[model samples]
Every structure is written in structure tokens, then in C-alpha cells.
Target: MTDTIIIGAGPYGLSLAAHLKAAGIDHQIIGEPMGAWRHYMPPGMMLRSEAFASSLQAPRSGFTVEDYCRLKGLAYSALGMALPLETFVDYGLWFQANLVGETQQADVLSLRRVDDEFQLLLTDGRALTARKVVIALGLKGFAQTPPPLQGLPARYASHSERYGNLEWASGKDIAIVGGGQSALGLSALLHELGARAHVLMREDLVVWHERPQGGRRLLARLKTPDAGLGRGWRSLFLSECPGLFHRLDPARRRLIMDHSYGASGAWWLHDRVVDKVRISHRTVVNSAAIENERVVLDVLSDGRQERVSADHVIAATGFRTDMRQHAFLSRELAEALSTQGGMPELNSHYETRVSGLYVIGPASAHSFGPVMRFVYGTKHASPTVARHLSGSLKADARQRAPARRPRAAAGASR
Candidate 1:
């Protein structure tokens, strides 16, 4: 048995493994590296955050995008600058192969508490027991399609997450929803691929920063730890000092969600994509009804109701943290877990109410602040979680006998 079993080998899982290795902790990390990133992201997309800011954290800090770029003779731009999503995936793979080697491609089907440890049953019918488990599933299985569009036929409607190729929709008129970066990026891709695309959003204007005049000078300042928007008093109070924000209680959390979760496109995508697409802002889809293989949507815009018809409707409306959406989570386990404003509640150290089970990544946003969902939070989360696991395993080691190593040939695949 291993000291810990980490699920979902994305940035969070890989970084946790690196930290555990540095601390000399005996652990096993399962799942494909950057699995969600590889499967969900569009083909030819770019990251909203800068290259330097996006990296897998480890005890040795020098091994980052900055170092990787310099070694490969690539330019190292400041934070908030965009990098192609494919390039970022390549970088993540390189980091995983070099830093963490125990990664296996396995799908965990169910997790149950057994004695003081947890038993993870794999899809292949293998069982592994670990002292603790950390769940770091990324945006997959959490993409939220709006309720209003749920009943539409599959051919006439789909969510952005379901899109893999634009060839199927070539020479067709498509209506894209939402005002976030993904919506704009998809619009740009479809337009470039010979599709007639138009974006509809409820917001009046697209709020995005224009390019900085002097290269990286202004962008770097905004992303710094002590300057600009990210370092302002309000940001600090929400992230660094969460107590102030948490004190408001349940009623306030819902109000904050409505206001804070509003979507806006990224700065890099403004002139490149937003300028090209025809946007009908301040327009809300009133009702969607099918009409002869087309989706007829009744929309309200500028104090007038309008009818629109489209061959396909794609909802880029972002995801929610609803734990019920995870079908694998057993009903018993769901009931046992605590919740905060429809999201799983977690402790400061990323531990949930259930002993020996922990959650990280986007799911842990309520506990560790909003940074938990972004790449930057991995810096603090990985080390802290590893330290906690190390201490807990050491304590349990005194009470149990040394784990017996499974016979290698006996457990080999048939």
C-alpha cells in the first residue's frame, strides 16, 4: 500500500507528486497526465494567462516555464500574456515525464472508506488501498450546460465542451452563447474555418483591456504580487485574507456568486476575435423551440423581442461547482460530505469533512479562496497537502505492520 493515492493527473496531481517526492514520501499517482487539458480544450486555442504564471509547482522553484523557454531558445514573456494551449500542453508533458514517473493511466470507478484508509476500485477490477486520497479532477465532468437549452435535439444544439471539430458545421449558421474567453475563441475558430458565426451575450459591452503600448512593461506590473489589479486591497481581502469575505455567511455567498461569476473575454482575444464577430450584446434568449431541424430562439434585446433561427446553438456558459453532477460519487458519500453554497466545503488545508478524503483544484475554491481554481494556487496547495499527508502517514505507520509488496508477475495483466 502507498502512503497516498492522487486522482486526476492534471497540473494539481503532478505538482502534488513532485512535492511528495521532494519530501521523500511514499506515494502513487494514477491517471493520465494532463488528461483533461488534452481532451477538453479546443484545437488551436491559446491560454488566457501568461506562460510564466502557468507551471507545475515543485520544491525546486527554478524549473518553470521561464527556465524551460530559456533552455529551448524561446522568448519568455511576462504574466497576463497569452500562450498557445498546445504549447502549454507540451510543456506540461515535458515536466511530468522528467519530474514524476509513477503516473499510470487508470480510471478510478469508486472510492470507499475501509478501516482507517481508503480503498480505490479501478475500472479494470484492481484494488489499491492508500492512507489518503486527493481528488484533482479538472474542468471535465463539470462543464455546465444551461437548463433552458437542455431539451433541444442533439443535432441542433450542443455545449462548447462537446465540440471537437469544426468540419461538421462548415458553411452553416451558428449561434454562440456567453461572453467569456472560450466563447470568443470558439467564434474565432469557426469563422476562420468557413462558418457563419454570430455571438449573443447579455452584457452591453465586451470588457477587455487593450494591448499595452510598451511591450511587457505594463502587463508585468498588473500581475505582480504587490502591484496593480491582482494586488489591490480588495483582491488581497478576497484571496489572502479570506476571513473578511467568509464572515458574510450563506446569504451573502449566493449574492457574491451572482456578481463575481459574470463572464468576460480575455484581453488578447479582443481585437483578434471580438472585433471580427458580430455581437448582439444585452440580448437574452427568452425561449428555445425546435422548428423543422432548426432552433428558433425568442430573444429580448434593447427593450424589444426578436426571433432568431440557427442551424446549431452552442452554449459557452461556464461550469458550476455542483458535486451532484459527478455520477460516480455514491449517494451515501454525497450525503456525508458537507457543502457551501452548492459546492463541496473544504477545510483550510484542502481536507473535506470525510476523513482520509480530500479535494483540490476548482472544487476547493470555497476553502482556499478563488485562486484554488487557477494555476497559481498550485504553489501553496501542493506543498501544504503533501506536508499534511506525510505527517498523517507517519502517525499511522506506528500502528500497522509494513505493507507487503504485491507479487509482480502474479498481478501482471492476463
Candidate 2:
């Protein structure tokens, strides 16, 4: 059996695999490299994360986004620069190739515990067993579509995460819900593609992040230090202190999750969306129906209801973590795992209640904090989990090793 198997070869999986490989752990990392960024996100979209914060974590140097840019002779800055989605995806692939090595592209058909080992069935009718499993499946199987927009036919409605290309949406009337980066950014891309995009948000006002200043003096820097999440003390703490976040009362943690990062657009997206895309504040879709083969929305804004029609409705409603949503998990394994607010309850090592089963990436956010939702969190997650797995694997090896027989007195043993 392999020492470990890491599912999902995105930033989280690739990052952790790099650490495990460096430690000489016998393991396999599977799934398409940079799958979500390459297949789910719309082309031409700019990443909300600044250039510096977008690197994949690894124990070795010369593998960060900045390093990749320098090697490619592309212009780069730690702040104030908008990282293109294509560039970030390319960086992830490069990181995988240079550090994590080959990743199995096969899909995991199912995963279940078989006695002491975890059994995984792959797409090619192949079965692999491992002592440990890490689910780093990024944001897959977690797209959250609001109730009113749910159950609509595919022709009339879909989630924003389902789109990797916007060409088909050109010249179409599109209605989007939510006020966050996804909604606003997709609106900007759709508008630029000649689509009439209207954004309906429940918030009375849209929030836009301030452009990152190039340089700040000591006092300003001290007051609001820069971190992977953003430029503020709170952001810094959340970015660097997931352990502390986990130690807080569950209710307080939930409060932070709800209010910490409300819907907002990136600084660069503000110009592209404002005065270009039509956005209605304090508006929400009450119901949706097909009228004349078009999606009709009963939208409520400022306490007044209005009828809205569109060729398609997109829910940029973001994701919700629930371990049960992963279909590959066996019924027995699913029931064996514990959850908190739909998230897998993880320990300090990112292990679940099921021994040898662990979850990382966005799914670990509830246990680790909001940082796990972003690539920068891999800096903490990869090394931390790798250290724990390394020690555990070593102890297992010692137990399996044949004990040496006591040496008999010189020449006494036959």
C-alpha cells in the first residue's frame, strides 16, 4: 500500500505533496492539475488575490508566483498588480511539474476504509490502497445556489462556477445574484463580451476594496500590516493565526465567518463594473419561472417587487463546505465522519474522526479558519499536515520492521 494518497492536484494537494515528497514519504497525488482554475473559472478573469498572495506553498524556494513571473520574464509586483487567471493557473501547473512531479489524472470513483487501510477505486477499474488519504478537492462539490434560483432548468439558470468560458454568453441578457467578487467580476467579463449583465444583490450598497498602496511608512505599516488575506491587523491575524481561530468558541468563529468578509469587489474590478454593468442594491430574487422560454425573476428591491427577464440567471453565490457532498466517499465512510455546520470536523493535523482520513483546502476552513479558502493557506496547511503524517508514517514503519534478534555470545549462536 502507498503511504498516502492525496486527492485533487490543485494548489493544496500539490503543495502538500511537495512537502511529503521532500520528506521521502511514499505517496501518490491524483486528479487534474489546476483543474478548477482551468475548467471552472471563466477565461480572461483576473484573480482577486494580489500577485504575491497567489503562490502555491512548498518547502523549497524558487516556486512562488513571483519566481514564476521572473522566470517567464513577465512584469510582477507584490501589491497593486492584478494577477490574471491564466497566469495563476500556469503558475500552479509549473509548481506541480517542478515540485510535485506527475499527478494521476484518473478520477476517484469511490473511497472507503477496508480494515486498516483506505481503499480507493479509480476510473480505469484500478484499485489502490493507502494508509492515509487527503481530500484536497478545492471548491468542487460545494457550489451554493440560493433556494429561489435552485431547481431551475439548466437552460434558464446555472451557478457561476460552472462557467469556464463566456463566449456563449455574448449578446445574451444575463442576471446574476450576489455582490461578491465572483458576481461583480463575472458581470464585468460578460459586459465586455457584449452581454447585458444585471447584478441583483441584497446588500443596500456594494463594497469595493481600496487599491493597494505601493509604499507605506512605518506607522501606517505597523497599524495595518500586510498579510496573505489583505492589508489589516484582522486580515493579518486571520491569514497567519488559524490555530488561534480554531481555539475560539464555535459561536464566535461562526460570527467571524459570517461577517469577516462580506460581499465585495476587488479594487481593479470596481472600474470595470461601475458605470458599465447594471446593478441593483437591496434586491433579491423572490422566485424564478420560465415565461416565453425565458427566465423571469420576481425581484424585490427597496421593499418593492419588480419583474425581471433574462436569457439566463447565474448564481455567483459562492460555495458551502459539506464533506457529505463528495460523492466518492462511501456511505460507511461518510457516516463515520463528524461534521460541524456541514464541514468535516478536523483535528490540529487536519485529520477527521475517521483515522487516517484527512481533509485540506477550502473544506478545512471551518476547522482552520477562512484562510483555508485561499491559496496562501497552503503555506500553513501543507507543512503542518506533512509534519504530522511524516511522524505517523515513521512510527508505522518502526512497528512493521522486523525486530532484530538478540546477538548470542561471540560464536555461541549456530
Candidate 3:
């Protein structure tokens, strides 16, 4: 049996695997490297995060996005530059190749606890056992569709997370539901791809992040320091002090999360979206129906009902983190998890209530803080988890080892 198995090859999984490998821990990582980014995101889409915030964590330095940029001679900046999706994916792959290599490209069909170990059934018909398992499955199987847009065929509707290319909607009328980054970004891409794209949102106004400033004066930097989340005292606290965030009462923690970050387009997206795409604010889709091979949305806006017809509707609604949604998890295991708002409760080291089971990445955001939702959060998660697992695994090994007999005193006994 392996000491541990990580079930994803995304940023978080790969980073943690790198740390575990450095710590001389016996583990296996499985999944497609940069799977979601390579398959789901649109071709020309840019990352919402700035350059410095997008690095995958490792045990050592010289593996950052900045390091990759320097090695490749690519233009680099901490902010004020939009990172292309291709560049970020390439960087992740590079990290995987150089640090976390030979990941098993297989899917876990089922996961259940057996006696004292966890058994994993793989798509390749291989069964594996491990003392510990880490679920790093990023955002997969958690797409949330608004109730109004449910039960529509793929031809009529699709979630934003399913798109790797927007060319199929060229010259078609598309109504995107939501005002967040996904909606605005998709609208921009769809419009630029020759599709008539419009945004529908429940908010009266669309919020846009102000452009980030670089090379500020020392006093200005001290006043508002740049952080992994963003620039501000609150952002600094959330970005750096996830442990503290986790200690607050659950209700207060949720309150902080609710008010901390709302839907807003990236600074670069504002110029591409505003005035370029039609946005219907204070709008909610009441129902959707397909007529004559076209999707029609019955929407409420400003207390008035209206019918908006589009060739297809795209739901930009984000993901929901329900552990039960992971079908691979057995019913018993799912029910055993103590959760808050469908998120698994995690200890300080990111372990679940079930011993030897851990979660990282966006799935841990509820317990760790909003930082856990971003790639930047790997900085804290990777080493923290590696240290805990390494120490615990070693202790377990010592306990399992056979005890030595008392040595004969000065060769008196043979």
C-alpha cells in the first residue's frame, strides 16, 4: 500500500505532491496535469489573477511563475499585465515536469474506507490502497446552474465551466446569466468571436476592479500592501491569516466571506466588456424554454417581466462545494463528513474528520478562508499538509516496526 495518494494534478495537487516528494514521502499523484485549465477555459481568455499570485507552491524557491518567466525570457510583471491562459497552463505543466513527474493519468471511479485503509477503484480497472487520500479535484463536478435554467439540453444551454472554445456560438444570439468574471469574460469573448452576447444579472450595477498600480512609493505601499488576494488591510489579513480566519465563529466567518468579495470584472475586462456588450442589470431569469430550436428566457428586470430570446443560454453561475456531489465518495463516507454549507469541515492541517482523508484547493475554502479558493492559497496549503503528513507517517512507521530485544549486558548473555 502506498503511504498516500493525491487524486488530482491541478495546481494544488501538484504543489502538494512536490512538497511530499521533497520530504521523502511515498505517495502517488493521479490525474491530467492542468486538466481544467487546458480543457474548460476559453482559448484566448486571460487569468483574473496577477502574475505573482498564480505561482504553484513547492518546497523550495526558483519554481515560481516569475522564475518560469525569467527562464523563458517572457515579459513579466507582478501586476498591470494580463496573464494569458496558455502561459499559465504551460507554466503548470512545466512545474509538473520538473518537480511532480509521472502522474498516473487515471480517474478514480470509487473511493471507500476499508477497515483501516482507503480503497480506490480506478477507471483502468486497478484497485489501490493507501493509508491516506487527498482530494484535490478542483471545481469539477460542482457546477451550479440556476434553477430557472435547469433541464435544458446541451444545444440550448451550457455552463461556463464547460467551454474551451467560444467559436461555436459565432453569429448566434447568446444570453449569459450572471455579472461576475465568468459572465463578463464569456460575453467579451463571444462578442469578439462574432456572436451577439448580452449579460443578465440581478445587481443594478456592474462592479469592476480598479487597475492595479505598480512601483508605488514606500509610504503608499505601507498604507495598502499588495497581497495574494489583493491590496488592502482586510485582503492582507485574509490572505495571510487563514488560520485566524478559521478560528472565528462559523457565522462570523461566513459573514466575512459574504461581504469580502462580490462579483466584479477584472480591471482589463472592463474595457473589453463595458459599452462593447449589452448588460441588463437587476435582472433575474424566471424561466427558460426552447422554442423552434432557440432558447427563450422569461426574465424579471426592474420589477417588469420581459422575454429575452437567444440561440443559446449560458449559465455563468459558479461552483458549489458539496462533498456529496463527488459521486466517487461512498454514501457512508459522505454522511460521515461534518460540513458547513456543503463544505467539508477541515482541521488546521486540512484533514477531514475521517482520519487520513484530506482536502485542499477550492474544496477547503470554507474551512480555511477565501484564499483557499485561489491558486495563491497553495503557498500555505502545500507545505502545511506535507509537514503534517510527513511527521505523522513517520510516527506510524515507528509504531509498526518490531521492537528490539534487550541487548546482553557486556556480552554476559549469548
Ranking by TM-score: 3, 2, 1
Candidate 1 — which residues are off by over 4 angstroms?
212-233, 236-258, 401-414
Q: Between prediction 1 and prediction 3, which has the larger TM-score?
A: 3
**Candidate 1: C-alpha lDDT:** 0.75
Tens digits of per-residue lDDT for model 2, 1-414: 899999999899999999999999999998999998899899889888788888999898999999999999999999999999999999998898888899899999999998889999999888999999999999898999999888999988999877888899999999999889999999999999999999999898889999998689999999999888899999999999998888888888888888877799999998899999999999988999999989999988879989999999999999998778889999988877746656788888999999889999999887888899999899899998999999998898898899999888997958
What TM-score does candidate 1 get on C-alpha atoms? 0.87
- For residues 1-414, write the lDDT of model 3, one tens digit per residue: 999999999999999999999988999998999998999999999988889999999788899999999999999999888999999999999999999888999999999999879999999999999999999998998899999899999889999988998899999999999989999999999999999998999888989988898999999989999998899888898898988888888889888877877788899998899899999999999999989989999999889999999999999988888888888998888987737756898889999999999999998887878998889999899998999999888888998899999778895956
Q: What range of 10 consecutive residues in model 1 has the weakest lDDT sum?
A: 224-233
Cα displacement (Å) at residue 375, model 1: 1.0
Please state the error at residue 79 of candidate 2 in Å.
Answer: 0.4
Error of 1 at 168 (Å): 3.0
The full ranking of all candidates by lDDT, starting with the best, is 3, 2, 1
Candidate 3: worst-modelled 10 consecutive residues by lDDT: 333-342
- Total backbone collisions, model 2: 0
For candidate 2, the per-residue lDDT at 347 reads 81
Clashes of each: 0, 0, 0
Tens digit per residue, CA lDDT, model 1, 249-283: 65675565556535666677777675678788898
